[model samples]
Target: MTIATDKITYSFAEYLELEETAAYKNEYQDGEIVPMTGGTTDHNKIALNFAAYLKFALKGRKYNIFIGDVKLWIAQYRQATYPDVMLIEGEPIYYETGKTTVTNP
Candidate 1:
């Protein structure tokens, strides 16, 4: 039950380019790239179920629920994470090269 150990290092510029269209998403942090693992079918089902419930329960609220491939940047730690579920409000953030900074989950 371990993620692959190919903790290859990448510069910020290289990371941005790699993220543009990598087959599977990679999480960037501390000058290292950790290949993301695909979740099981059960994981997908549960996530969808939760998302559906949240959407219905939060109808008319300002919160937005994102399912997958959404970037969460934590600028304080210079890392970026892709989370299973994220709720965000207001203008969205985009990584424009190294122009944008990120943080870990």
Candidate 2:
């Protein structure tokens, strides 16, 4: 489905095509493409610190920790956005063939 706007509308596939070449990230909300804001220093620090702690705690366990940059697809909300951090107990389930977006946390 394409997003309806005064200027332009883009389908999910089209959004993916644009996203591939975008300098920054864009989130898919319902049908709109929302550009993501850059993270502040404090935000980065907090994300990194939490990820590090989780990694250490889950060392030698069957788990994976992902920080910012990993997209999470929330189908129920028809949205896909990057999360601060993700803790997957096992292999990640992707939203599509690509490894960037994940369907399950």
Candidate 3:
């Protein structure tokens, strides 16, 4: 389900601060923080199955497949989104020092 916001604008820094403590995930669009909706059971199953298949197919290869929990930081667009699936061939390029966010997929 989607979480409703107050419609007030926020700076990127402010958004990040709020996101750090937010119970649910939120998408950053420019300067707005939009709450993300949860996926259906079918969607979750599909994503997990796809990731599992990729892991099996790419076995012995140098790659990492992430499911829906990781955050993707798009620097150019100033957006942080959680994709259904993400694959990074090599070491991920992290956005910050803690290594919690990645800039490259």
Candidate 4:
């Protein structure tokens, strides 16, 4: 289930800080932080299959393939999300020095 707080809104920085220690994945939209729902088994299998295929097809290439766990930071929308699969070619552009958040796909 997705959890959204209506009583209090959080700033982008505050959301990021809270997310670091959050038990579950949280999505930041504008100034609100919402908890993400866990995907079903079928979803996990599909994502894994896709990632495996990409890895095989792009073997020895410069592209990096990430599945489900990496955080994607979208500055224009002020949103942070975890996509099912992401493929980044060449070096990735990070949002912070921690290098845990990526700004480019």
Best by lDDT: 4
Task: Give all TM-scores, in the order shown.
Answer: 0.74, 0.87, 0.85, 0.88
Error of 1 at 50 (Å): 1.5
> Whose lDDT is higher: candidate 1's or candidate 4's?
4
lDDT of 1 by residue, 19-75 (tens): 877888888787887788889999999988988898888888876777766777766
lDDT of 1 at 58: 83
Task: For candidate 3, write residues 17-59 as lDDT tens digits.
Answer: 8988999999988888899998899999999999999999999
| Tens-digit lDDT track of model 4 for 1-86 | 99986677788779889988999999988888889998999999999999999999999999999988888999999898998999
Instruction: Give per-residue lDDT, candidate 2, residue 105.
Output: 87
lDDT of 2 by residue, 24-75 (tens): 9999887889999999999999999999999999999999899988888888
Rank the candidate models, highest TM-score first: 4, 2, 3, 1
lDDT for each of the candidates?
A: 0.71, 0.88, 0.86, 0.90
lDDT of 4: 0.90
In model 3, the Cα lDDT at residue 2 comes to 100
List pairs with backbone clashes in candidate 4: none
* lDDT score for residue 85 of model 2: 93
Off by over 4 Å in 4: 1-7
